[model samples]
Target: MPLVETAFQVVDAFTDKAFAGNPAAVMILEKFPADDILFKISREFNLSETAFIVPKYEGSTHEFHLRWFTPTAEVPLCGHATLASSHVLFTQMTEKQRQSGPLRFHTLSGELSVEFKTAAPEKLSTRNEMSLPELVMTPDLSIDRNVLCDAFGITENQILFVGSCHWGVLVEIDASTTPLHAIKPNFKAIASVNASAILLATQCGTDLHGEYDFISRMFAPNLGVNEDPVCGSAHSVLAHYYANKLKKSEFKAFQASARGGEIHVVYDAVAGRVRIAGDAVTVSKGVIYM
Candidate 1:
C-alpha cells in the first residue's frame, strides 16, 4: 500500500511570541480523512484543539470547509483554532491566491469570514481580523449560587452568574478584591455543573496590566481541558458583556492562564457580530504519516 501522509502546522494563536499563547495543530488537506483518524490525530496532538481544513467547491462564503476537534469530541465553534487556520491560509497560501479578497470559511457554527490587512512595508508581521457571531448568553437560573461559588472556591459575593450559552455559564468575579489568577478551581466540582464549561472574568485593576480592560480564564473540564490558555469562542461572549458594561465598542482582553495571550475585540451592532483580531506565529511543521 502506498503511504499516505499529510502536512500539519503548529501555530501559537493570539500572541506574537511563541510559547505564550494557545497552541493549535492545523491540518490542511486536499480531502478530509475519516472521522476516526481526525479524532486520533487530535488525541495524539493533545493540544486544546486541532483544526482540519478542506477546500469548498461552492457557497456564498465557501472558500473552505473547516472543522474543529478536541481530544474528546468535535465542537461547534472554536476561536483560536479558527484564527490559527486563518493565519495559515493568509501566510502560507500563494500570494496571488490571497490577493483575491477576504477568506470565507464554512463552519458548523455558520459562515465566517476573515479579512487580511496589508502591513507597512517596513513591518514584518501581517494582521488579520475575523468577524464571529456574537454569542449572547442568558442568566442561568437553574444553578445554585452556593454550589457555583464552591466549585470556584470563591464566596457568593465574589461570583455572579452572568449568563449561560450553548457552551456553558459565564461567571464574573470581582477582580478588585481577588485577582483572576489567584483563584484555584476544583476541577472535579466544576465538572459537575450541567453546563459544558465555566468562563470566569474580572475587571482589570490598576495593579494588573493597564492596557487591558479585562482579564479572563476558561475552564472546560467537560471538554477535557483544565484550562484553555486562550479561548476565542469565550471572548465572543465576553465581548458583548464588556461592550455593554463599559459602553464601548472596542476592548482589549487578556487571558491570564499560565500561557497568557492578548485579544482585541470590536462589537459591530449593525451586523450583530464581534470582530476579533490577534496575532499568530507558526512554531513548527511536520508531516503526519498514517
Candidate 2:
C-alpha cells in the first residue's frame, strides 16, 4: 500500500510581506495524529515550527495543539507558530467556520484566544491574546559576563543585562551602537550558562520614528533557532519592562531579524496578559507525501 500523506498550509506569521516573518507549517487534521508522525512531519517540513490541529470539545471549538521543533529538539511554547496556526484555521481552512469573531484554542500554554480583523487586500490581521504564566522578575542576573561576551563577540560593556523573567535572560543594547549584521553570537558559549533563551533589545528613542518604541532580536540556541523573526512570548516580558520604563501601556516593537517583523503590544497589568497584534500573509498551501 502507498504511504499516507498529509497536507498543510504554510503561513508566515507577524509579517504582511513574504519571507519577512517566521514560517510555520499548519496541519489541519480530522483527528489528532500520532506524536511520532507529527514529529516526523515537523522534521520533514524543517521550518522553525509546525502546528497540528484537531477538534477538541465540539466542532465549533477547535483545539489548536502546537509542538515546536527546531532541527534538534521540541519546545514548550512558540508564539509565531501559534499565531500562524490560528490564521490558517480562521482564514483558509473551512468556509463553514466563521471568520468575523474571536476563535478559542487550547494549547500547552492553556486556553488562548485570537481575534481576526480585515486589513488591506490579501492581508489578514489578528490579535493573539496569550495568557502568560506569572512572570518572576529578579535583579539577580547570575549570568557570566565573560560567557556573554564570548558568545556575541562583544565586550562586557556592550551587553546590558535588563533582568530575568522565568528562565529567560533579557539584555538591552543601544540601537545606534552596532548593527545586527556586524555582531555574531557564540551560541555554544551562551548555551552553557542558560539553555532557555536570550532576548536582545535596543531602545527606539523618540528621536527616531514615532511609530515604534523599540527594536529587538531573540536568540534561542537550545531550541535550534539562532534568531527568531518575531517573538510574542519575548514581548510579554518586554511589554512589562517597556511599559514601566516608558510609562506607556501601548507601543510598537520591531524585530530586526533577517526576516523583519513588527508587533503592536498592549500591556494589561491587571489581567496579566499581553496582547500582540500583527498581520499574517499566507505564502503557500500544499501537502506532504510521506
Candidate 3:
C-alpha cells in the first residue's frame, strides 16, 4: 500500500488558552480519502474528534466542506472541531477569506455557520460563534437507573432527570448533594448502559454566586472516548434541556473535565437552532503521513 502524507494541525477548541479545551486534529485536503483511511488517521491521533475540511464552491454558504470523525466512528456533528476549523481559517488562511463574512460549512449535519466576531485579534476569542445542531426528545426512550448508576458511579438517587436525543443521553444530577465534578465514572461500565445511546452527558446548575450558570461533563465510551473535555454538540442538548427546566434561554456553561472549558450558549427558539460560541487556540502544527 502507498503511504499518503496529509498535513494536519491540532487546535484546542472552546478555550482561549492552549491545552484547556478539547483538541482536534484538522486536515485540509483537496478531497477526502476513503472512510477507512480517515478512520486510520483518526485512530492515530487518538483524540475525541478530528475535523476534515476541503475548500469548495458548491454550497450556498460555501467556503469549505467539513466532517468529524472519532477514533472509533464518524459523528454527524461536532462543535469543538468546527471551532478549531474556524480558528484555522481566520488565522491561517488568506486575508480575503478572513475578511469574508460568516463561513458556511457544508457538513453531514447540514449547513452550519461560523464567523469571526471582531476584526481586531485581541477580541477575537470572545466571538468565534457557530450555530450548532438542534435538539430532540426521543419519546418513550428508557434506560435502567441501576445501569446508569453503575456506569457513572453514582447512586440511583443522584440521577435527577434522564432524557434522550438522536445525539446522546442527557442526565441532570443533584449537584446540591454530590459535587458535580467530583464524580468519576467507570469507563468500563459505560458501554453497559444502553446500546442505542452514543454519548452520556451529565449536568448541574451552580449556586447564585457561582462563576458559571451551569456545569457539565460528557462521556462517549461507545465512540472510544472516555471523556470529552468540552463538547459543543452536547451543549445543543444542554441548552434546550436546561432552558425548559430553568425557564431561561441563555447561559455560561462549564465543562468540568480535567481539561476544562467555557461555552456561551443561546437557545434561539424562533430559529429552532442553538448558538454555541467559544474560543479556540492552535497548540501545534504538523503533518500526518498516512
Candidate 4:
C-alpha cells in the first residue's frame, strides 16, 4: 500500500504544563481509515489513548467527527483524549473559528461540546458535558473484598467503599488512614478478574483536603491501560459517586497517578449531565506517515 501522510499532535490534558497530565496523540486525518489501520496506529503510538478526528458534513449541528482508540481496542468515550482533541482543533482553527462559540463533536457516546477558555493557547481549556454514569453496586457480580484488596495491594482496613459502576468496579480508599498515591496495583491479576475495568478513588485527606476535594485512578488491563494517567470520562462516574457521598454537585478532583492531573467537575441531577472542565497543553506536533 502507498504511504499516506497524516498530521498529529500530542497533548497533555487536564494540566497547564506539558508532560504532566494524560498524554494523548491526536491524528488529524482527511477521512476515516480502515479499522485495522486505526488499531495499528494506536498500537504504534502505545499511549493510553489516541484520538482520530476529521471534518464532518452530516449537518450544521456538528463540526467534526471524533473517535477514540486505546492501544488494544476502541472505546465509546474517553475524557482526556477528547480534551486533547479539542486542544488540537482549537489551535489549528482560524481566528474566526476560534472566536465562534463552542465547537460541537459527534462521537459514539453522543454529541460533545468544547468551548475555548480564551483566545490564547495557554488559556485554553475544555468543558465536556456528558451523561452521568450509573454507579450502582452489583453484589452478585462483584469480586470478594479481600480479592480486590489483594489485586490493588491494599489492606482490608484501607478500603472504605466498593461497588460497580458503568466503567467497572469502583473502589474508594480511606486516604485518611492510608495514602492513595502509594498504591501499586497488580495489573495481571486485575485483568484476570471478571470486571471489564476498575476505578479506585479516595477523598483527599490532610495532604490535599483543602487543595482538592477528591482523588482517583483508573485501570483497564483489558483495554490495554494498566493505569490511565488522567481519565476525563471516568470523572462522569466520579461526579455522581461523590455527589451522593459528599452531598454536593461541584468538586475539584485529582487523578492519583504518576503523571497526576486535576479536573473541576459539576453534576446537575436535573440535567443528568456532568460537566468536566480542565486545561490542556500541547507537547509536540508532527506528521505520521503510514
Candidate 5:
C-alpha cells in the first residue's frame, strides 16, 4: 500500500522572527510507519527533531499518540517538537478536530496537553504544556573532561558541573566567555564519554532584554544533533537548578542556538513539576500524498 504523510514547519517556543526558533518537521500518519522509514525521513529532513503522530486507545478522550525522534535515535521527551506537533494539529488538521480545544498526547515521557488559540494575521498558535517528571540528580561523573575541553577548545576549569539526570552531562559556563556559534563539540569523543546526551548552559543573569534569567544551548550528538535550538527536557532540569539557586519559582529562559528560542517556565515545587510554556507558529502547511 502507498504510504501517507503530512508535514508542517513548526516554530518552537520562540518569540522572534522566522528561522530563529527550532524548526521541526511534524508528520501525521494514518498508521504507524516502519522504524527504518521514520529514521530515513528524519535523516532526509535533517532538522533537530521530527515528530510522528498516531492514534491511541481509540476514543479514549486522548486525541493521539505522539513520538519524537532525532536524526539518529528516538528520545523520551522533546518539548519543542511537542509544541510543534500541537500547532500542526490545531491549524492544519480538520476543524472538527481543531475544536477539541486541547489535545492530549501519550508519549514516552508521559501524558501532555496542547491548547490552541487564534492569533493575528489569521495565524494560529498552540500552547503545549509538557509534563516534566521530577528530576533526580546523580553524582557519578563518568565523562572524560578532556573530550569536552577539546571540543569547545575551552579549559576544563571553566565547566561547572550542575547535575545529571536520565540524559547525561549538565554543565554551566560563563555567558560572556562562550559564543553560541563558536560551539563545536567532538561528537565522537563526547559520545565516548556519555551515552544519552549532554546539555551546556550559561548564566545570562538579567543581561538580555527579556524576562528570561539565563541563556542555554543543548548538544546531543549521541542522539544525532550537533546542537538543539531549544530543549524542553533540558529546561526541566534547568528549572530545578535555577530555582534552587535563585530561590524563585518562575523565570524566563532563552536558548541561544542558531535557531534561537525562548520559553516561559514555571517551577511548581509543591507539585514537583516544571511547566515549560511557549507558542508554536505554523510556517507551512501541506499534505504528502504517498
Candidate 6:
C-alpha cells in the first residue's frame, strides 16, 4: 500500500497551559478509517487517548462522528479528547466550516455536545464546555478489598467509600494531603480489579484552601496508561460522587498528577448529566504517515 499521510494535532486538555494537562492527539478524517488503522495510530501516538473526528451528514448541521482510542483498546467515552476535538473545530477549522451553534458529536457513548465559551484568533487552545452522562456508582463489593488496598498502598480503614462506575472503580479516601501524594499504585495489583481505571479522590480542606473542592488521581494500568495527567471522564463520576457528598451541584477539582490540571463540574441529577468545562492548549501540529 502507498503511504497515506494524515494531519494530526496534539492538545493539552483540562489546562490552559501547554504540557500541564493530559495531552491527546486529534485526527480529522474525511471518512472513517479502518478499525485496525485507528488502533495502530493510537498505539503509535502512545497517548492515553486519541480522538478521531469525521463529518456527519445526518442529523443537525453541527453533527459529527467522534471516536476515542487508547493505546490498548477503544473506549466508550473520553471527555478530555472530546474537549480537544471541539478545540480543533473552534480554533482550527475554517470560519465557514465552523458551526455557529453547539457541536453535536455522535460517538459510541451517544450524542454528545460541546459549546464554546470563548474564542481566540488562531490561538493554541480554546475553552470548550461539554456535558457527559452522569455515571451512577454502586458499592464495589465484588473486588477483594485486600487487593484494592494493596494496589493503592493504603489501609482498609483509610478507604471511606468504594464504588464502581461504568468507566472504572472510584475510591474515596479520608486523608486529603500526604496520603494523596504518597500513592504509589502497584499496576499488577490494580489490574486484578474488575475495572479498567481506578479513580482515587479526597475532599479538599485546608490542603487546597478553598481553591478546589476535591483532589484526585487516575490510574489505568490495564489501559496502558499508568497515570493519566488529567482525566476528564473520571471527573464525570467524581462530580456526581462529590456533589451529593458536599451537598453542592457545582465544584472545582484538581488532578494532583505531576502535570496537574483543573476542572469545573456541574451535576444535574434530574438531567442525568454533568457538564465538565476546561481549557486546552495546542502543543504541536504535524502529519502522521501510515
Each model's lDDT comes to 0.83, 0.71, 0.78, 0.79, 0.72, 0.86
Q: Itemize residue pairs with steric clashes in candidate 4.
A: none
Give stretches of model 6 more than 4 Å off. Answer: 58-61, 93-99, 121-123, 206-210
Please give the distance, in angstroms, between residue 217's alpha carbon in candidate 4 and its true position after superposition. Answer: 1.2
Tens digits of per-residue lDDT, candidate 5, 54-137, equal 877654434788898888898888888887777666655565665666778888877777655543334445555555665656
TM-score of each: 0.93, 0.87, 0.90, 0.90, 0.85, 0.93
lDDT of 1 at 201: 90
Sorted by lDDT (best first), the order is: 6, 1, 4, 3, 5, 2
Distance from true location, Cα of 67 in model 1, Å: 0.2
What is candidate 2's lDDT per residue for 235-270, written digit by digit as tens?
A: 877888787778988878888777888888888888
- What RMSD, rounded to one decimal, does every model reach? 2.5, 2.9, 2.9, 2.6, 3.1, 2.1
Report the number of the highest-TM-score candidate.
6
Q: Where does candidate 4 stray beyond 4 Å? A: 58-62, 122-141, 206-209
Clashes of 2: 1
Candidate 1 positional error at 265, Å: 0.3
TM-score of 4: 0.90
For model 2, the local distance difference test gives 0.71
Model 2 RMSD vs true structure: 2.9
lDDT of 1 at 8: 92
Clashing pairs in 6: none
lDDT tens readout by residue for model 1, 11-44: 8888877787899999988778899999999999
Separate clash counts for every candidate: 0, 1, 0, 0, 1, 0
Question: Across residues 124-186, which tens digit of lDDT does each residue of candidate 6 receive?
Answer: 768889989988778877778899789888788778889997789998887644457567888
- Give the clashing residue pairs of candidate 2, or none: 151-186
